[model samples]
Target: MRTAGLALAGFLAAAPAWAEFTTGDALVIGNARYGETVTAFGPDAVQAVARALRLRGQEVEQLANGGAVAMQQALDGFVAAIDEGETPLIVVLSGQFASVDGGPVLRPAGRETSKAAGLSLAAVLEVLAQSPRRAFLVLGEAGEATALEALEIPEGVTVIRGPAAKVAEFAAREMAQPALPLEKSADWYGLALSGHASDGLAVLTHTEVRPPSEAEQAAARDRIALLDETAWQRAVESGAFQAYLDSYPQGLHAEAALQMRDGAPAISPAKAEASLALDATARREIQRSLTQLGHRTGGIDGIFGPGTRGAITAWQRQSGTDPTGYLDAAQVARLAKEAAQSPAPSAPRPRRASNAVSAQEAATWNMARGERGLRAYLGQYPNGAFAARARVKLSNMQRGSGQ
Candidate 1:
């Protein structure tokens, strides 16, 4: 079967041309001269897009058919333009991209020599990392790569990579029309995009920031006041103003609630989660619930990091909540309940007899692993020596989790 094209995860956004409204900087390097053996990449296409950017008044630093030294000089110019202003920075390199011993490098024109002959993409990526908001790196693969290696792209920066000619074409077309988003355009070309570049990224964007009109400000105040009043009424009915204040710091009756609690510090969302005093075991249970519910919390490890935060955000987005990427006491409870209603991620692994771990040790380990993993072991070895260890482990777990 024939395939369309291979895509790594993530997306990229090209900036709008801005000789007038915005100032956008671009670094475009096209290296087509590899050797007689390699296929020539799109030198003409990248230059076309560079010309398009320049036409829109963007500071364009382009190196056409450049060698390693020339490519390095182009990178310096790109950075200098960025330091001059805070604007959208677009970098495009179309040529023989390959995975070398050190890292991902673009083989410059007139280079069939050592790995050092190629320009390091890692350095360019580092520069892009700084201006992440408007930073994007469009890598167009010129020739067929013998080995496809994953490039380590940082957060906030977008990346769109595919066959050199097609991507360069896409970039040229999209840059010409700033209104066309990348997601919609890439879909037609079978390209994949990631990061903030998703949901159709466009070139030459000027985000006009103006204060909300009188009507808009009034509407917002009305909404917040209504929420505050409702919370206040509920607090009065339940005589739990302290709890109400903990949940809403800016409620209408917040000052009254504060007086009721003798001016206790309001519990922030972060503080509330910390108040759970969750141990590793409790954390794993939370992760399990999230994973089981198909949020994919990376792994069932206890610590909550970016993966867990992302999972939480995903869950919130699905549920139409605030999507704050943080969990409070109530949100945790809701997640637990929802996960119970949902099916498991996968079936339990069947026990296998192996010399590496004895049955008793396995039973104890299973006890350590959550989700009633101890049933098989307990049903068989009710009074084994390992059973005693498992019981002690459970007690430690309960204490650690503050349960």
Candidate 2:
């Protein structure tokens, strides 16, 4: 019953709430219970999927371990609200599934394995048929998709079948970065990707969305960072990213501080690492190696803004791989090896030291992954720009995932 229309704003940052939105709803169901036969399924994966969807401004119907009655009601409600346009739509069904009539039906918890007790998969697929271009059906780990060939799935609706965790990952990691090649993505996650837009289009990220009003744009100013605005502006104007960070490590512009300091675009890399969990040092190394090979990264800093990606694209072209401007593990290794054998194209760029602090606050906030990292951040900089936001985020990540 949660109408999460405006929950897409940056959860942790004191940013405006829901400035843009993809029209439509997502139905996410996770059933971990099946009496004594199956071990109790956790809500973690489903919840993660819901959170990611919400962060992307998708309204989600998150149903956890619903019984027969609950399942029917939720499904009916979600299907009832659908419109057959180019609206973003997602449905994640995770749990035990029963195959009857040579088709799959979602089975309720407990000893009931009968088709009468099962929810028809065709009903869900039928709804998906409406907006094939903007729809996705992720068959999560538990209820393995069986005999899908016989199911006459429509052309546009993408179907991804995989573990619940991977499904969550597709939602969290891949959906937003549609440019990331899906083949490698599916291979890494062991997901069987299909459907209309599955070949290339990032259905969720690519789906058309309504932009916010001018008023909403004006309201994007950080209310929490009012005090730090003057100082932050000074730092940026003087190109003293480090200096400003040094002075106000906990300032509102902490993360932005670092990006401005020496990196490329002020792109935050924490939440959107494109599924490649490279740390600052690792990213810098890649940049460094690329530079040695005459690929300019704009700077040797870790941030992979347009410059770095462009360099990557160049290298990919030379190496005879798809020039995605992105890196995979193999590509990363190859780049490193090539760099080692090749001579230094130019001397290592001197690290810029224009005084720094505020950006560190951002680094702490951006780098913190879970409760432990957040707690550690709080312990070090209790009054940092994102401390309070981190606390609230941990308490409730759905709305409080920090910027």
Candidate 3:
């Protein structure tokens, strides 16, 4: 598939002095060089975008027919630019994403001496970690599906790709729409954003064979509505892309789902060690709340530190709240209430009387059982309607045998 192009529009008002935007700080490394192997898109992508966005003060750079080392140089240049306090710098690569042994390799030009150049997702992540700024990526006819699949990015980055044949068309599509709102749109799998870029509303436009039908539009609305917490939870549990996309497509909640999908690592102790810079009022409030919750978390400490996260997680687990370590608004409110309570030591809820199981519940139970056999069945169906009935029937059978 062809990669998409961006056509970001200028803000009506000049961006604040703090904001910086660079659309063409990109290097195109393949095909277009005179002595390189076959070309994918023309070598003029960098120049073209540079000219288009030059008025906006974006410095465009091109690395034509670059080999592996050349590509590294370009990447180093980009890093240097950002280190020097460049606010917004975008990187676009058009070539082949080859699945070399090192993961996803970028096959730059000069294949005669330079072996297939591959840049794996891990490499990309390293680049991102080097700078605090958000970034965007555009892959134009870069790789096959296998290679493309390996190019994962961290949060605040975007990626877009399609079959090599459609790359030019996709690029055109991206150009017409120029830029989509990073915060508002679903995570751009093939695009990256600069952390301090001006907040212009993203707009995309393109001609298509047909407009979506009314039924299709309604179906989409229904699907989006289904992307509630339940659907998201289900997708995470299943770890299936289809299950995920079925609920949330390219919409507002997609990024959140993707974050979950990307498997956010547990916040490391090192990260947690940094004390939250809380004001006096916040510290006092937290301390008071902790005392009320019957926790001796070593005094409120006036900082949201390891002790606070532990307390919050423990409270959440005990209160049937999602045990995600981070406390959001809803969780915070509930935690505040828990702090006020002098409850019995946290324990599991008493079993309910009703034994009636919904079809949905049954389906989940069956899936669990299939995954973990008797253990799964017992764990999920504990004191459930079926389990309650089975217990009673077993007791009756034992009594009859004794008689």
Across residues 216-237, which tens digit of lDDT does each residue of candidate 1 receive? 3443343334334344444554
How well is each residue in 289-382 modelled by candidate 3, as lDDT tens digits?
7556654433333433334446667766877876654555555566667666755545343232222356765665444321144345556667
Worst 10 residues of 2 by lDDT: 218-227
For model 2, how does the per-residue alpha-carbon lDDT over 1-403 read when each residue is reduced to its tens digit? 1121334445486866543233457787777666544432345656677666655545456655554655675676466445335367788787766667847777765444565666667888888788757777877666455645455577777777776666666766665453465556666788887766445565555332334333322222222132244344445445555544543456555776766566755455321233365766897899888988988765665655555767999999999998867677788899999999998676545322111236776576556765688798888766454444455434433333433
RMSD for each of the candidates: 24.6, 22.1, 23.2
Badly placed stretches (over 4 Å) of model 1 are 1-20, 37-43, 146-148, 206-403
Query: Candidate 2: lDDT of 17?
Result: 59
Give me the overall lDDT of model 3: 0.44
The lDDT per prediction is 0.60, 0.60, 0.44
Sort the predicted structures by TM-score, highest score first. Answer: 2, 1, 3
Which has the higher lDDT value, candidate number 1 or candidate number 3? Answer: 1
CA displacement after TM-score superposition, residue 357 of candidate 1 (Å): 68
